[model samples]
Target chain A: MGFWKTWFSTPESVSATKSAAFEEHTASTGDPSANSDRIVFSTERDIDLYELEELCDAVGWSRRPLRKVKKAIEHSFLVASMWQVRGNQRRLIGFARATSDHAFNATIWDVVVHPDFQGKGLGKALMKYVLKKLRSEEISNVTLFADPHVVDFYRTMGFMSDPEGIKGMFWYPH
Target chain B: MGFWKTWFSTPESVSATKSAAFEEHTASTGDPSANSDRIVFSTERDIDLYELEELCDAVGWSRRPLRKVKKAIEHSFLVASMWQVRGNQRRLIGFARATSDHAFNATIWDVVVHPDFQGKGLGKALMKYVLKKLRSEEISNVTLFADPHVVDFYRTMGFMSDPEGIKGMFWYPH
Candidate 1:
């Protein structure tokens, strides 16, 4: 199918080169932490779901079934996470994923940072990484569902609620 | 990867059975129309991008690049469309797609109906078809981005805007 041609022709090599460049940039412009406590970010989809669920739990979010979580990750267009690496004991600290049309629009979902990792700029770093990656893939128009309390946090990162007055709506089976 | 096991193990057979049943149901309880003008809905992914683009244009939506549109369709979890059949001629009248986590959450996108087909309950039927398909897969939460004018329309079908005070946010590159 021509669709497969378009899908396979996505600029993966360009994204890989950009990701390497961003890693270098991130390393040079480091966040404050000791060498042993460095935070590393990755776009790898093979994440440890148990660690992700624990991170969610640490942030007071409800538990998602690991089976469903794995399904979500499998179907996602992009999954990014941040980890605190302390002498090979890596801990999932921040997590986010986006489902996209892989073209005109994408919506960010399940963004959470462990409570202990909050206020250390990890959330901002994680979001920046996610947005930059989307940009690398040439996807425009990123959207997200946010809790009311954290609206300002996203605002600082250039996110606006309901741009052009396009409202978000939901349906739940009764 | 265990992830592939989960992805491959999705209940395709169950969904297929439900889709066949739904097709039977629709054929029996369809909207008022002569047999010649019957509207049929399908979950098939191999839609003609040009026809879809024409339908979007007929609804006054800005033209999306067909290449990106194809990429979007390839990545979408589900793509559903409604068509008006007249003997040998099938005209695309309505379209919608969703990107899902395949378990917990799904966001409906690019919902549109040709202007000629509006006000005859085709939009409602199209949405019902999409929601039924999602429910068959056991997706719990469904969300969509709506223009302010259509908010009431979705509300009439059990969609609430920002339920429980959750907000929607967007980010665009400067």
Candidate 2:
């Protein structure tokens, strides 16, 4: 069992996954009582940085520069943005960013919906879109650090408090 | 003020970073008696899948396909693999993976050193390399889920126990 022997072999490139099962759940957007056909969701397509900054600011997140936010969106493995398009204009209503290896693990970050759109179910739809995207890739084991108030919201999406023995730790560089 | 007006501006790419300060800490390798110049630490060149699998197996992590491991190595925002090379042969002994937005936050995963290399201070050297890399990128906030026993190891590097009111949570899809 010489482990060193395999070190010199040529490495393979990562493969691309199929488009997620977005079509089946397109109707899951919007209130069932309202017209389901009205809302549109896009993933990593035609995103606007100013709207993203607004989405963060509207939720009281720190104001990061536009470039940082764009890099965050571009580097994420899955990004969900729910929009309300009228004529030629699009409004970013809900957004989330996730990073993963496209294999074993993923962690979701910055899940937020514009305050005005909170009760309209856009947040739930955006999360489901994220899950659908990960499921399409067969990547499970997702984690996220959440504020206490949103624990219930995340719980509804199948996230749970970490088990008894596990603890999350942080370090902030000076 | 119209918030959406900044949407059309072109954002700058995240900037490049200087090399992490790797001092004459080379003697931290195997034994002080052996010359320290033989070990080379690489951010992303010459990773061996078999040795990575062996490292994971030695520590009881779940077995993953070779390609998945290679992809994980390739996609990380920063990766450090400490290797010992003599002539044309190299052995990977320590490894760490971290993902970040290159701005605000980074979480480290799979910080492992070969069992044979455990007590030789390789882990500390590897973690310091990780911190140095993150510092250069200006990603100030970092987190990692650590085993209770290793909490002290991380604290030495400036990771405090997460403060009160913050809890890490997880979701595993069936």
Candidate 3:
């Protein structure tokens, strides 16, 4: 509902949602504490490959060891979309990840907000960032799954019922 | 529909889809002249991890090396609803991985037919394989997002229409 801010200063960062992702070897890390705390707006960063693994671990998304994380970083940058409010480096408040051409469209999967940071409008703000990035790159479509409980939120964001009315699918190799 | 023969024979494969992949790395020597025509499904021992990689490469789905492949295999086995088909020494043909607890089910992904031996009914055969596995598991609810062009094929296979259509979503963290 409000204007979105750019994650990084570089123009390449604007349209490049996960550049290393398509190429395969990626590590994402971000400065979650940049803003530290301001409900209106905050600073965000790219969670490079290595940093992403740590965040995933902190959040218990995947039980991968640091060794594997190290090896994975060498191969493909982990593609994940994340946001930190008030610069909480100790935690990743809201996050998501998807694979895409960036120019065509984006698939937004796993929109999660940290337990302590929920209901503060951080999730929306982060997604707005993602949608804005995708749109800037000429991506007209931004798709995601809304847990039935929160379908209204996504609906407000412009996602509609699929022609089949079925929830989108996701798979975690790990 | 013709009856599909999907047998999950406990063939003793030397390389089982385990939880630890990279640790089980093996050297690869591609059969450059491998009968790129008809792949003779050999025993598990005959098809080392490397051979699996080769077959996956030749087919085009993906062979995420030992590390990543191990996780996928574990996930496949862990989910009470996996219909795996492995061949003799270094010979693996059609495969379809599904995730479900046997009640509400969805196969988020899979169908890796070796490229060299496609168009010979392997993909369809694999789908049949998946169907049989699901039915036997007593899983009546199976869902997935078939490409627009392929929706008809799924309908022909007995998958009903999606009353509420949904598209998958993703957003990579950078």
Model 3 compared with the native: what TM-score?
Answer: 0.39
Off by over 4 Å in 1: A1-35, B1-35
A50-74 in candidate 3: lDDT tens per residue?
A: 5555555555675545554333223
- For all the models shown, what interface RMSD does each have? 1.0, 1.8, 10.5
For B1-174, candidate 1 gives per-residue lDDT tens digits of: 322233235566435534543464356556454534556666667787888988888878898788999998888888887777677677788899998878788899999988877776768878888898898889999999899989999999899999887888889876
User: B1-174 in candidate 3: lDDT tens per residue?
Assistant: 000111225423212322111121111113344332222221122223464566567756444547544444444411211112233322455444554332333343444566644544445544554565566555444555555655665666666543344344333322
Tell me each candidate's TM-score. Answer: 0.82, 0.77, 0.39
lDDT of 2: 0.67
Among incorrect, acceptable, medium and high, the docking class of model 3 is incorrect
Which digits, one per residue and each the tens of the lDDT, describe model 2 over residues A86-147?
A: 45455777788888766667878889888977765667777877786777777767778777
User: Model-by-model lDDT, in order?
Assistant: 0.78, 0.67, 0.42
DockQ of each: 0.64, 0.41, 0.09
- Residue pairs with colliding backbones in model 2 are none
Q: What is residue B34's positional error in candidate 1, in angstroms? A: 3.8
Ordered from best to worst lDDT, the candidate numbers read 1, 2, 3
lDDT score at residue B110, model 3, on the 0-100 scale: 44
- The runs of at least 3 residues in candidate 3 whose Cα sits more than 4 Å from the true structure, single-residue gaps closed, are A1-36, A39-91, A102-105, A164-174, B1-144, B147-174
